[model samples]
Target chain A: AQSVTQLDSQVPVFEEAPVELRCNYSSSVSVYLFWYVQYPNQGLQLLLKYLSGSTLVKGINGFEAEFNKSQTSFHLRKPSVHISDTAEYFCAVSVLHNQGGKLIFGQGTELSVKP
Target chain B: GAGVSQSPRYKVAKRGQDVALRCDPISGHVSLFWYQQALGQGPEFLTYFQNEAQLDKSGLPSDRFFAERPEGSVSTLKIQRTQQEDSAVYLCASSLAQGRTEAFFGQGTRLTVV
Candidate 1:
């Protein structure tokens, strides 16, 4: 079985400040990592994914994440954030060849950007 | 539709009643999935279907929960004798051909059992 753990349940930051959301996974097999953002009453939107190749993957809205194989971590980061970026973020993991690509998600971290 | 679509954005059913949630995946998508998201928690996998065949259903909480995708394009999750524990957002997602492809999500149907 695979699982994801997010270190923070909530993260508060000021506008234009940098932010990082930590995620760790436990999987015996190679896995694909992803970051998703969900606004209140809305579906989840893909932020970024780390499938293969580069360890550093960049995603939409100037967000990025690094897949550290050694630590089994894929943490999301943004150099600067805006008020519009406030939302609930989830870290997910999927086994490389799992049928239907079922995603195991973390508890989620709520990001609140203040002015 | 441009993306995955779920109907009845909100549903309220009395305890012991039955409810069915619908999901419309992207056209031509070969894989579909269902997940449950409780308050303040992440979505948990419930079931998976490839084409019209249900490949996995191990995540279903109990036998009372059932899902089906007859033609593969649209799917439905039926909860029999609904309970308060079944009150959560049911999300549907689909991918082009499965594997490592990105799965687009629907807005989800929020089911509340009173």
Candidate 2:
């Protein structure tokens, strides 16, 4: 079984400030990593995913994350944030073609971009 | 539909009442998934379907929870004898294929059991 861990439960940043949300995963085999954002009362929207290729994956809303294999991490980063960026972000993992495409999600990190 | 759609955006049920939530996946989607999200927590997988066949259901918390995707397009999750613990948002997602693909999500059905 695969699992995801988000190191931070909440992240607060001022408008136009840079922010990073840490995520780590534990799995015996290869996996697919993803970042999803959820606004209040809304469903999750895919921010980005790491299937394969470049370690640095760019996502919507100027967010990006680098996949670190040795560290087992896929941390999401945004160089500059806006007040509208405030939302809950989730880090998820799916086993590589072996686990039937089910996603295991982290506890989530709530990002608050203050004005 | 252009995207996944779930019915009854919000539902309030008395304890012990049975409730059913519906999900309509995007057209031509091959894989559909169900998840449950509690307050302040990430969404947890509940079940999965490949077309009309239910292949994975290990994530369903209890026997009280049942999900089916008939005709390979629309799905329904039925909860029997709901309890306060069952209050949560139910999310449905559909993917283009069976593996390593992005899944589109629905707005979710929020269920409140009292």
Candidate 3:
């Protein structure tokens, strides 16, 4: 079983300021990590994912996440944020060996970018 | 590309009423998944289907909740007796079934049980 935790329920930042959304996971086996964003009244869109080979994963909209094995953390970050980047962010994990593995998601962090 | 799409973007039902939500995955995607998202929460896995076969359903909350993807393209989630607790946005997603591919999602159907 795998579980994800996004420490911040809500993060408020001014436009052009850097922001980081914290995510941590617990899993007994090797896993894959992912970050997703959801706009108002929309479904989740894949922001980034961390599989094998690379601990640093980049996604669309200039966002990126670092997967830390020792810390069990995969935090999403961007050098700067825009008002358009305001949305609900989620972190998810999937089993690497379990073919039937399903994504387990976090409670979510609402990123509010104010101008 | 036209992303995943769902029908009846919003639905309202009285308690004990049956409701059906529909999802259409991207064309030719082999894997489909259903999730439930309560307001202010992330989506929770509900079920998974690979092709026309149901591979997993561990996340369905109750026997009243059922999902089917008969032809492996469009899927339907049927709630036998909708309850207030069932009020949430039902999301559908599809992936390539290849290595490390990301899942694309539909806008989701919001079910309101009054």
Ten-residue stretch with the least lDDT total in model 1 chain B: B94-103
Q: Over the stretch B8-41, how does candidate 1's per-residue lDDT look in tens digits?
A: 9999999999999999999999999999999999
What global local distance difference test value does model 1 have? 0.95
TM-score of 2: 0.98
TM-score of chain B of each: 0.98, 0.98, 0.96
DockQ of each: 0.82, 0.78, 0.65
> lDDT tens digits, residues B21-90, model 3?
9998999998889999998888999999888999889899999999999998999999988899999999
Best by DockQ: 1
Ranking by lDDT: 1, 2, 3
Worst 10 residues of 1 chain A by lDDT: A93-102
- Sorted into a CAPRI-style docking class, model 2 comes out as medium
- Residue B99, candidate 3: C-alpha displacement in angstroms: 6.5
Q: Residue B82: error of model 3 in Å? A: 0.5
What is candidate 2's lDDT per residue for A17-94, written digit by digit as tens? 999999999999998999999999999899999999999999998999999999999999999999999999999999
How is the predicted docking of candidate 3 categorized under the CAPRI scheme?
A: medium
lDDT values, one for every candidate: 0.95, 0.94, 0.91
| Residue pairs with backbone atoms closer than 3 Å in model 1 (clashes) | none
